[model samples]
Target: MAGLLDIVDQAQAIACEDILKVDAFLNHQIDPELMQAIGAAFAQHFQNDQIDKILTVESSGIAPAVFTGLALHVPVVFARKLSGFYGENVKWLPFADMQNSWWISILITLVLMGLVSLLLALNGFFRK
Candidate 1:
């Protein structure tokens, strides 16, 4: 029987007596090809933009971020869930977000910074 998951997945073809299973793909079973396709799509869409690095959260965002990083030929950075242990080189910039306002602002700021860095690097590369 179709339920919330069917709606979420935007399923078009499903029998009335059939039960759709997404846990095997989305939740439990991690499909490498599916992940790559997702990353490729994102990379293709953002290819026109100047992207220096890819950033995402922990766990779920890791695979997509890694794929995007590979496609874009750049590094990926993920914010930790809880602060416990990190290497010295791993920069820890405290996120200041009150009512999610600061979080959005910070994300935009980082994207812009990355864009500028990418542009500058490209310009320098061409200058040689």
Candidate 2:
């Protein structure tokens, strides 16, 4: 845990507040040692929770998921993208209709949700 914590301490939060960019270790450029440590730490933290499987997105998430699954003796599920990494038709359009005197917010939300669902299904289907 300390090793992972130390790595986290060294990593910086760039640009956005919610995003802690860890490209140097667990993301873009991977450090196997840190990832393994991370997996062990996660396993230790959730040892008594009775976890059966691990779910993670493709690319960056694979390393940590594999390590955690290894340490926990569980199966790891990878999210394989079909259309694209971020999915196709993934957008939000809050267009206003003057004639109808309304904003298409609900419609946009429904469309986005449907796109997300479709993407998930496709991703699951085209697992390689």
Candidate 3:
């Protein structure tokens, strides 16, 4: 498996202060070993936080998120991307499109509600 610094060296510079394109190992080629390392690193970083679940947006995040959940023995929940929300890494939000789409808001609400219900049911918070 490639080390963290080795993966950092593979990133493409985007003329940012601290941001570098990670599509080389994350999105485009999707080096699983690197993601596993990333998961382990995240698990180590947040182990003391007592996190019960891992939440992230879909696509490339799914890989590291799942691996991190595995390392931490927690459930991973990914938000579904609808339309222009698609991106490699999360840096900003598209407020204009969100303002225009009420259905998007409803869909997201429903998705969250469903996830909550599922979690509740799984944890026996919802008892018949």
Which of the two, 1 or 2, has more TM-score? 2
lDDT of 3 by residue, 1-128 (tens): 34866766656435487787877777777888878888999999998987788878878889999999999998888878686544446665465356556676678779987997799779975342
lDDT scores of the candidates, listed in order: 0.67, 0.76, 0.78
lDDT of 2 by residue, 1-128 (tens): 77765776777525386766788786677888988888898999999987877878888889999999999998898878677545257464334334542445556668986897798668874343
Worst 10 residues of 1 by lDDT: 1-10
lDDT of 1: 0.67
TM-score of 3: 0.56
Q: Which sections of candidate 2 miss by over 4 Å?
A: 8-19, 84-92, 95-128
Highest lDDT scorer: 3
Q: Rank order by TM-score, top first? A: 2, 3, 1
Give the CA lDDT, 0 to 100, for residue 38 in model 2.
Answer: 82
Q: For candidate 1, lDDT tens digit of each residue in 9-96?
A: 6633244557655444445555566667777878999999888877687777788788888888878878676765433455644443
Q: What TM-score does each of the candidates earn?
A: 0.48, 0.59, 0.56
Q: Report how far residue 13 has shifted in candidate 1, in Å.
A: 13
Evaluation by lDDT, superior candidate among 1 and 3: 3
RMSD to native, candidate 2: 6.8
Instruction: Look at candidate 2 and tell me the lDDT of residue 42.
Output: 92
